[model samples]
Target: EGVAAFVASQGTLSYQLEHFVDSHDLLGRSVCSMGSSGSKYISSHEDSDSAQTHEGVTVVDAGTWVSEPALWVEWTHTGRLESVGETRIFVIDAERMFKALLHPGLRAVATQYAGEFHKRVVTAKPPLASYPSDIEVPHADFCGIVCCMAHPWRVQIGMHAFRKLAAAGGFGTGIAAHMKSRLKHEILTGRSVLVVSG
Candidate 1:
C-alpha cells in the first residue's frame, strides 16, 4: 500500500520501518557532488545470500526531492573540497520521520559512528555577549493588583463541596498527587511559585 493509504488505515506510520532506496547512478552522483568517493563498504565475510545489507540506511542530502506529501530536509557540508565533496538534499516527511530519526538504537550508533554529528550539525553558538551598560531611564511606575474577592458564602460552599468530594474519594486523586509533586519540586528548586488564592 502507498504511504498515504497506509497512514489513513493505520492512523499512524511506524517511522522506524521507513527506508530509502536509490539507484547506483543517483547514489554515486550525490556522493560525487559532495566531493566524496562512493563505494559500498562491507566486510567480505559479512555478505550473505539471505541478508540484505544496508538496505534500510537513510542517506541525508541525497539529492532527492519528495513532492507528494511536501517535505524536504535542509543540509550542508563543512570541510575543503579535497576532504568533503558535494552535499545533496534528501526529501523527508517531517512529522512522521522524526521517530525514524530518533530511534534509540540508531541514535546510539549515529552518536558513536558519526562522532558528535548531531552537535556539529545541529548546535548553534550562543549569541555574541553584550557588554554591560548603564544609562539614565525615564521614571515610569505603574502598579496594580488584580483582586478577585468571592462572596464569603460562595467560598464556604465551594470549600464544603470540595471537602465532601475528597472525603468520598470522588475527586481525582492522581491530579492532586501530580499537583502536590509539582508544587514540592518547585519549592525545592527555589522557583517562583504562583498560588491560586481563593
Candidate 2:
C-alpha cells in the first residue's frame, strides 16, 4: 500500500522529468571542458663572462580558441544547479516525509478495523473442516486468508465474510484454541500455518 501510494504520487511524467534532468546534468559535467591551458614554450636568454645575467620567459598561446566557451560555462553552471537540486531532494527526503505523514492514520485504521473484524469472524463462524479429518482441506488456508485480506479486493470480501460469521455467532472455543496454537507455531517457526478449526 505504501509503495503503491508512493508510485502514484510520483507519476510517470515526474519520473521522466527527474531522469532527463539527471542524465542531462551528468552528460554536461563529463563533456564540458574547464581548465587553464599550460604554457607551451620556455625561453631563456643569457650573457656569459665572469658574471652571467640570465632571464627566463614562459610563452602561452593567448589566442587559443575554445570551441564553445560560453556553452561550456553554461553547461558547467547548469550541472552545478542540477547537483544542488538533487542534493536538496535528498536532504528534504520527501518520500520519507510522505510515508511519515500517511503511516500513522493508515496503520491506525487498518489495525482497529481489521483486527476487530477478524476477531468477530472467528467468534461467530463454524470451525473450518477439522484438521486431518478433511483430507481435502489445505493446511495453509489460514495463512492464505491472511495474505488475501491484505489485498484490496480480498479485504472487502474478507470483511464481509467476517461480518456474516459474527452475525451468525457460529465460532466455537475449540476452533479459537486451534487457531491460537497454529499462530503460536507460525510465530516460532517464522512460517505461516493455516488453522482450519479457527
Candidate 3:
C-alpha cells in the first residue's frame, strides 16, 4: 500500500493508498532492458527464494549502471494508513518498493549476484556525490502560513516504524540499517536540516 496525494477539482488535497493486490501478474517480468535475463522484479509472494530465476543480463553502460550486488528483500504490506493533517502515510508492497529502488537507473551493475555471494563483493566503480556541496537552496515566499513542516512527531513515528519493521527480520533489517546510517551522517555533518513550523 503506497500513499499518494492529488488535488481534487475543488482545490482540496486528497490522499489515498495504492491498495495491495495479491497478484503475480508481473512476477517474472524483466525490469532491466539490456537483455532478457537476470533477477526478476520482486512480487507480492512472500517466498523470494522461490521467485528468483537466474539468467544473464548484458550491462550496456557498466561504468555508470553497475552497483555493488546486494540481496533483494521481500516484505509484506501492513495495510495500515495514517493521516497527519494534509499528509497521509502508508507502506507500499515489497514488489513496488523493490522495483522503484532496484530500478536499472539506480543500480546499474551489469552482473547480478545471488545468495550469500552478494554480501562479499563490492563494485569497483568509485562512488559519486549526488549533489555538489556548494549548491544553494532556493528561497520561496508564501504570503500566508504555508505550513510545510518537519514535525518532530513525524520523525519519531518514522523511526519507530523502521525499528518495528527491522525487528521483524529479513529485508526490514537492511532498510533500518541504511536509514540509521543516513540519518546519523546528516545529523553529524549538518548538511541538511528539517524545518519545524508551528
Candidate 4:
C-alpha cells in the first residue's frame, strides 16, 4: 500500500530529475577546449586538472544518459506491479477492500461496518453512518500495521479467537499460557510486542 501511494505521488520522477541535473556537466566541452587553446577567457591556470575532470565527466554523463531511460522504464513496470498487488490483496480481503475504498480518515468506521457485515445475525445491511463505539478510533496506516498488527481492536479480536483455540487445546498449555499473558500486556500498554520466528 505504501509503495503504491509513493509511486502515485510522483516522487520517483522528482528523484530522477534531481539525479540527472546533478550528473550533467554543462561546461565540460568548453572547459576542455580552453585547456589546449590557452584561451584568455579562461582564468584557471590548472589546464591539466580541468581536462582530466572533463574526460571523466564525459564518460559518466554518457553512461547516465544511456542508462536512465532504461531504468525509468523498469521502475514504471515495478511501480505498476506494486499497485496491482495492492489492489489484488484488497480485493481478496473483503474487509480491507471496503476500508480502502472509504473516505480518508474513516478507516475505523469502515472496519466497524465490515465487522457488522460479517456478523451471522446481520440479515440486512447496516446503516452507513452509525458504527459501534468500540471501533470509533482510527486504525493504523500500512507501516504502522506492519510494525504491529496488535491494534487495540485487533487485540480484542485475537483474544476472542485465541480463547477458542485454547479451549480446543490447539496449542500446548505452556505456549498458550505465554501467548495469553502477552496479549494482556499488549492490550494494557497499547504497544506492540515482537514475536520472531525462524
Best by lDDT: 2
Q: Which lDDT tens digits does candidate 3 get at residues 53-112? A: 223211122111111111221212322212222422222232454456665633332112
How far off is residue 122 in model 2, in Å?
40
lDDT of 2 by residue, 42-63 (tens): 1232111111222432222222
Q: Local error of candidate 2 at 77, Å?
A: 30
lDDT of 1 at 197: 30
Candidate ordering by lDDT (highest first) = 2, 4, 1, 3
Which segments of model 4 are wrong by more than 4 Å?
1-151, 164-170, 175-188, 191-198
Clash totals in order = 6, 3, 5, 0
Looking at candidate 1, what is the lDDT of residue 64?
15
* Per-residue lDDT of 137 in model 3: 7
Candidate 2: worst-modelled 10 consecutive residues by lDDT: 8-17
Give lDDT: candidate 4, residue 187: 43
Q: How high is the CA lDDT of each candidate model? A: 0.25, 0.27, 0.24, 0.26
Candidate structures ordered by TM-score, highest first: 4, 3, 2, 1
RMSD (CA, Å), each prediction: 22.3, 30.3, 21.4, 22.2
lDDT of 4 by residue, 36-149 (tens): 111111111111211222322211110011111111111111111112111111112222344466664346533553343223112211342221111111231222332343
Where model 1 places Cα greater than 4 Å from the true spot, the runs are 1-90, 101-103, 110-115, 122-198
Off by over 4 Å in 3: 1-149, 170-179, 183-198
Candidate 2 residues lying further than 4 Å off, grouped into runs, are 1-179, 193-198
Residue 3 local lDDT, model 2: 13
